[model samples]
Target chain A: MRRALILSLALIPALLSFAIAYLFQRGAIADFVWSGTYQIDAAGLFSRAGLAGSALIAFILLTFWWAEGRAEDTFQAERNMQEETRRRFFRRLDHELKNPLTIIKLGIANMRHTPEISSQQQASLDRIGQQAGRLQKLVEDMRWLSELEAPRLEQAPVSLAEILADAVALARAAYPDRAIDLAVQQAPWPLADISGDRDMLVVVFRNLLDNALKYSTPGDKVAVRAADDGQWAAVEVADTGIGIPDADQPSVFEELYRGSNVQAIAGSGLGLALAWRIIKLHKGSIRLRSRQGQGTVVTVRLKLPAPRD
Target chain B: MSKPTLLVVDDEADLLAELKPLLERSGFAVATAPDGRRALDSLQHLTPDLIILDVLMPHMDGRELLRRLRKAGNWTPVILLTQVGTPAERAMSLQEGADDYLNKPFDPIELIARIEAVLRRTRRGDAPLSSFRRLRSGQLSIDRQTRQAKLDDDAFSLTARAFAVLEHLMLNPGEIVTRQRLLDEVWGWEHAVETRAVDIRISEIRKALSAYQPGCIETIVGTGYRFIHEVVGHA
Candidate 1:
């Protein structure tokens, strides 16, 4: 739409120049043929000038079309290359972080066994162990996101119910006080598993659950419901909390994009982006319908693969 | 009886100085080694009833020394002493023939208890388990119930916990009783306490045996305590 608008605007100046020149040439021809009397030659010259002007305008329009198409192609190519480079950098970073993390785990284990340490010291050490575990999880998230760009989406029959259950369990453990009302319309939901990376699926649910917990006011219900859409599994995580505004909705899934209303909330702003990538990888679509003061409902439809041979 | 001997091996001079006198006061004939090589050298000439081995050291670490000692068939009960032993590291050590482990900056009382228990365990027997009603393994004699123990026909002096510990080993004979099981059976604790507590008691039992029974208890690494059902002469 923007391209068409620019092309029309550019052609307007050319159209005006042709219209003025055609009028001037016609006035000049009026004197040559007969200033006081009309002649057939004057009319002929006027028609020829009009024909010439239309031919020139058509040629200019064709040139503008070619230039606009080339520019768009170049812009798109640059955007894709930039995305690829960013992914490669993150993947390498994740792999590098994991090596030291493994070593730290082994070293900490060795330290914990030394019986000479006091109990107080041991408790402090355990806390450090938990933090390291969290770091390991973050690195895992990075690796999963980088994998999304690969062409062949690795799909396998995954238990949709089990994944939801696990996510609910984690949320409960994280926020035992929160009243999270989970309603499954189809209790065990066709036992129909969607085909996607189980790890990625777990991450998706976790991200949504995390957001739900954060945005949810105390005593508000965060509902999780799933339905088998025959060809796809549609899961919705609806939170009755502060929601995203209309203008910022389109940019929510953009890398590191945080909604203007929720910028003050603590988050890396990467969760939704990563979730979108996983959804995209499964050849699925995720839609968000949120009202600023009302609530937010994130609906994700994951394309399930055919049954195994 | 003479003082039960303890060989504390660590490269740190300050730690050795502070710990040695404390151990001596606790009724242990304390011996010190600055490094693993020196500790082994000292071992060649004299075998202390208990060895408190440091896990980290220059030239030879506590683990490597324990490995070398086991390879040479030296089954002297060792209490692994270090501040950095993880639970897994301690498990690996126990598996690798380390009789027990204690983290560093250790309490003197706990160290004394561990030493006594390990010593008592080592003096049970050097040979595999066999039924012997009036079993005599060198200075030690087992009079099964009446739960009586004697050293060369003299009544063996042992703490009640020490006696119970010794009895458990004698009954099991060659079998290994894990630290957890020992705590349950002997300490009467329904739940497992720190494995180190068992190590401490074992040290105490070993100390008593060193004075009364000599070499009777044998440590089966990584598994549990066992009685070396034979009278193996000292190195």
Candidate 2:
């Protein structure tokens, strides 16, 4: 189709010059005799007319190209402005939530020490404190998503095997009573390291591992496998537990999006979204594959820093 | 013998009201300030044990007050209460001479912990642990040059490599030590692919000391480990 378009574009100018030349030579185009009143200068003027028509066609194409470029620049500028606006909105939200949450938390902490409060009131405060904690975590994740726009990453060479091991350890620590079998498969070969903020990358993998643990039940197997293709290091977190419904897979990375099937499970629905944002900031790509009631597999790919001479 | 005094500075009157009683209950003689100028005014006559400054304020924010206090040669410990931001921003508060910082909406208990940590460092005159010949905390003690360690008056049997790792940890208690740094200092490897050796040594130390104290050495996931106890170093 592109070639056809180019061919037509070329043919339009040629066809016009041909007709112009023909009108000069034969004084008509398909029986229109508009050349009757003018002198039929058939000699030496044909090339000039064709050159003039070609110049006009080139000028029009140039104008269209410039206009398209301008439109794209405008589009890019608008996109950047939108991103900044979103960042500001989140920052303001974080500020608005910060003081009130602190006040509530401190107020509860102070009241807990009051001697007059009964056990039932203590339990109620505990519940309020727990729910307040959940809100705090949601706001924290939102802040992270905003900070990802202009992250200050401290770059250093990092090991993927160690990262997987740590991530698995954290997951196990979080659910010590759960009988899920969590394992980290060491990379067979010495994988090249990637440069990134160690803490930030840990947050990404921890989020992924937490999701794997949170969604699965007892006797389920959650495996973290690390491998490298000599250039890109790929880590896969696979779980043989309840998987995401096919319908919810597409919107998994949307902020505050929780899978409808797993509403009973405790989560902020921002884990995967934060993970995706962090990976994007690290210049890596992540992909997810899952089947409802079967299992889920998430793979993260990162380019290894080039070896120095 | 006397209660530690803390000057709390913030713009939120409700927060100030809420925090004053909590801090007083925590055994601190609390003095409240509406903003930085008043905080400075309190400083003219009152040299509290510590200052808790809020970062975002109407006039003279936490950073400015921190800078001004340091500029006037006042080395009083200050813990900045900042909104959640980048790690680099937190690092900046420290660079501007804040003893510590806590993100806003933090647990009041954690604020107490940070305050104690800052006071501990300042009260000790910020001495390096390596300067002392012996390090002691709780029932754990290590003789620096002799490479001798004891836990609960029992011999802490650790491999020489593990001992080196433990000694390094003792010298910098309550700070996260990266595995690569352990490998560099203890194993003497410039750059090695395997950091699992550091982990193995850490586990060895933990196992040997588990009977006496199980959780002294904490693994800072995905980075390294931290010796979670406060070790006093002296001759």
Candidate 3:
């Protein structure tokens, strides 16, 4: 309908110009044609020129509107194509990379069980195993990121406190040297149950706590606190670590984005991005506050389901 | 008596090969199969005490195999293995009659521990159903044969580990059961330097018990816990 309106509006000026020049100025035009070199009336000539100018302006406006719409359509199609390619590439990468990594890890496990290996050879094997583990983690993260791009969450009733506890246990086990504390201050009468994908939420909390531990030094305290309001449950993961710079805060949740000050830190930089996606899928919000040289605090708020009778 | 047999079915040749020897070294007679079909074939020839089934494989998957086994009235405890499982998958596996599951790249020691726990639970199920004595303290009662516990009107359920802990505490009422002892006896974790798991499970048991009688499990500061039996006919 809009296109039709634009087309008609564009033609109206041209039609009017033709009608005015031909119908009203017929006599002057006829006289000029008969005499071959006739006297020109400035008023009629200027009127005719004005009508032609209006027609040109209308046509230009129509062209601009049409071009803008076309550009947007092309951009959207390109974006969709790119996303599909990326998803497929990652899926293939995950399978190809993980299978080999699993085999290598299994081989390493088998070798470790052998009793005839020398200490030097064992050290080399251990190094290979550690590198293989790192590669496996990287592959897993990439696959996870791809999955998060279009997640179909299997929502269920899950306890926020239980998820927090599990995340803390995982972090502690991963980094045994670090002191991680989980403090649940205000729990609902019977622990608040949030309607969400439990596994995805676990990944969210794990990533947050993992980040807290990754950027911090040994012996640094990483604290996780959870509390429930009447309608929402809030969790905070705070750590005394090399905090993100002010300039880098906005981009922290961007895919593959890393803080400028974290050059020395080993990370794939997909942790926060994946967390943001999973939280968004659950209709939750995550916020990060950091002051360089001080610490970083990540706060997440998730909607709680109504208490069941 | 012959060692209890465990049939491990996995498509990964290298993994199956490595796991067979490791489990054998741990003192279990291990059987192997490449996939679900072969596993079913092996089952016909030998009725293993337990089965470790891999979730993803050619032809028939672990879930299908478990379904078939349960449908056939075979209740041999089966543990499913997955690469990276979600909680929903784990819950579904358990609902489908999987005794337990282990994620890939798990520690061999942890695998052994889980296997032992499952085997023990299954063996208990096969014993004389009601012949075993039920231990009682005040209003609380624990049936060793059924692995069920009751406190007054509230008949609460417990996990295998929690039930084991409760049974041990009730068997030695008034005695201060140390965390180390509980870990060693209930979990069979002899070298578990960290007793945090014991404390966590104890707290869980206490919460469950609180439904009927609060403070039945007393925390002995700086030590472990004591099951303080309530006096009969007391306010």
Candidate 4:
């Protein structure tokens, strides 16, 4: 419908020229007796008018192009501004909501500790505490997402052994019931030292291990191994559990994305997202290999720091 | 067990009302303050075992209150209740003197745990010997007998509170000490107060320690302060 309007507008100049040319042609074609009074050349007049009409068409097209370009820029800028404003708004909203929730959490906790609160109320409070824990994790995930855009990766001489130990400690704390088998070669590998944030790397490993434990069946073994491939260091987390389906592997790293097998799991779908972000920040790559029934292996490769001259 | 004493400071009446009965029933002797000024006024006579302090308040925010408290030799364990906007400040509060810091809208259960932890540290004792015994890292000397800090032969003069913080850090060495722990141990801040009281005192400790030895204390940006220098074994 709008295209028709533009086409009609473009034809106006041509139609006006045609009408004037028809009048000039009528006089020009008159007999010799009327030649002196009607000296107009129809073709010449129409040609001259056509040139002006062409120029008008060109001007119209140029104006259209310029307006469309400006409109696109304005639209994009407006969209960007809207997104930034939305992010800020959500961040503030998260903060505002956190306070009252905290007070409630504190109140519930205090109530639970009291001998006066009934056993049933304590149970209810326990549920509230669990939900609050979930809420806190959600808030943390949001904060992590915001930071992931340009997450700071501090580089310092870090002991890989120390980091792995910490990750193991965290895993033990996270799943005290789960049995984890860890095998280290008789001699500790003199791994290459890399300048990266140890805490972020810890999160990455912890998440990987946590995912392994979450997906694994009882009595299944979760194994962690590390090796140096000369140029990069490779750390693999392998678990004998319900593996990720082939179809869901691609989108696993996407933010807030969870696998089809994750429906029954208790998670915010942020573990891998955070892990991906942390690895990327450290200029590393993470890959997953899994089959529907077979176990899954997640391997992360990070560049080894260059030796100082 | 006697009810633990907790000082709840905030300008919001509704919040105070909500907190009072909740804490009272939980076996706490609760005191209330509407603002930082009133909080300090209350502090003069009532030394709460733990303080639940708001970061943003009228007539002296939590930070200023902590600064004044440290300057006047009032060391208390404080758990800072902070809003999201003040995260950087919240992190800094640990350095100031907060034993532990929790963001606002926190889970009351977690807050209680933090409060109890600080209270446990306080009950352990206020003496440097007890504080020093809780931490271990390098060969750093904190002479509680003379209230002197020495890095080998270098003499460092620290305020009583500053010395307390140093002692606390020396004990932990490489471990993270939240601002709340410092406030609870050094300043005797009873409740979890704002994190800034920690920031100011840490800055003071840093200045004094660095005067004797460069880069003696390392500021762990989002966590509490730690003494970074490796303690060399005495010959």
Winning candidate number (lDDT): 2
**What tens digits encode model 1's per-residue C-alpha lDDT throughout A1-309?**
999999999778667656634654556424333322333354454466575664464345446556778988999999789879978987677755743564455456556656699988899889888777666556645554565553423355677887787777777877988877675546554647877655456667778888888986886779899888667788899988888889999988866678888866876667898888878777789989988878899998887677666
TM-score for model 2?
0.62
Query: Taking the tens digit of each residue's C-alpha lDDT, what string does model 3 give over A121-185?
Result: 89999899888867766675666656553234646667888878877887888898889988886
TM-scores for all predictions: 0.40, 0.62, 0.52, 0.54
User: What residue runs in model 2 are displaced by over 4 Å at the alpha carbon?
Assistant: A1-83, A149-151, A175-199, A216-226, A240-247, A305-309, B40-49, B66-77, B94-97, B113-235
Candidate achieving the largest TM-score:
2
Per-residue lDDT of model 4, residues A1-309, tens digit only: 999999999777556545544544455433221222444343454445565553454344445556778988999999669647755765765666666666666566556656788778878988988887677667655555554443334466665656666677778876998877664333556766666766567778888988899988778889888777667888889998999988999988766678898799887787897788778878899999998767899999888887677
The lowest-lDDT stretch of 10 consecutive residues in candidate 1 chain A is A31-40
Worst 10 residues of 3 chain B by lDDT: B185-194
Candidate 3 structure quality by residue, lDDT tens digits, B1-235 = 6899999998889777778877888899999999999899989989999999988889898889999999999989898876543434644776687876766545566578678867776686732111235767777877776778888756788766677788767644565777756754554322211366567668778888775665888888877888888221111
Model 1 DockQ vs. reference: 0.02
Q: How would you encode candidate 1's per-residue C-alpha lDDT over B1-235 as one tens digit per residue? A: 8888888888767567666766676678989998899899999898788788888789998889999998999977888874432334544766677776764333345566667666665676432222233555667865644556677778865545456677667645555667655654454321212354466557767776776544567666775787767432221
Residue A85 lDDT (model 1):
90
Place model 2 in a CAPRI quality band: acceptable
The 10 consecutive residues of candidate 2 chain A with the worst lDDT sum are A27-36
How big an interface RMSD has model 3? 8.6
Against the reference, the lDDT scores of all candidates come to 0.68, 0.76, 0.73, 0.68
TM-score of chain B of each: 0.54, 0.60, 0.60, 0.54
- Residue pairs clashing, model 3: none
What's the C-alpha lDDT at position B160 in model 2?
63
